[model samples]
Target: MKALKKSIYAEYDVHDAFQKIVLLEMQSYDGTKKQQLKAFLEDMQRSGCISGMISQFIYHADCKKFYIEHLDDLEDIRKEIEDCLGEAVKDRYGLPHYTFMCWLCFEEYCYDIYRNSFE
Candidate 1:
């Protein structure tokens, strides 16, 4: 993965940093390589690196790649998410993709949404 010098949410608040990090990581996948991204998410979930909530959310959001413009809707949930993830989300600077997954898991805790599977 290429190092992200600056992020899409660089001008935004620290709470939105996960959006930027997710975007940077998504750069590795394109429409043609969506399967690889999906598989990676699935494996991460299976290995307990990502929670079931995040894995389901990704599938529901169809996040084969990141959508920079869609991050606005997530703002309302940011603080709740940060709080749920605690120290894992403290630093908005240079967070890796794996860490971002932890932040993503906060969505479930924040919204009280849980799904057994993405299907």
Candidate 2:
């Protein structure tokens, strides 16, 4: 809940180590927030969330800002997305279903991943 700063892979948990590999294999970042975002996008792609190249995720996905800022593991990022979506829906502020865009982005990214699979 506290932004996941306390748990960066949980002291070499195998699954956690694999998560780092997943992100690294997806894109290269200099340990910056951009890396976190790209990693999230890649995770979304694998999980059937959103799709195309990393560029598209950066261009249109509203949730990039949140991921870039949060810098947590995938599961926590996902929980936060759900919580944010609920809050965004409740409030009449920002864009219509503002946080919902994250969900939508995931869907698009998933489609992109599927489409690319055949190529």
Q: Which residue pairs of candidate 2 clash?
A: 49-106, 49-107, 50-106, 50-108, 50-109, 50-110, 51-108, 51-109
RMSD of 1: 12.8
lDDT of each: 0.38, 0.40
lDDT tens digits, residue span 1-119, model 2 = 12222332333232243334334444553455544544554555565322333333334344555434433443354455467567422322343332344444334333333344322
- Candidate 1 local lDDT, 36-97, one digit each (tens): 33443444445432343334234424442332333443443455456656733443434444
Which regions of candidate 2 are displaced past 4 Å? 1-96
Each candidate: RMSD: 12.8, 13.9
Among all candidates shown, the one with the greatest TM-score: 1
Give the range where candidate 1 is weakest over 10 consecutive residues by summed lDDT: 109-118
Per-residue error (Å), model 2, residue 64:
9.9
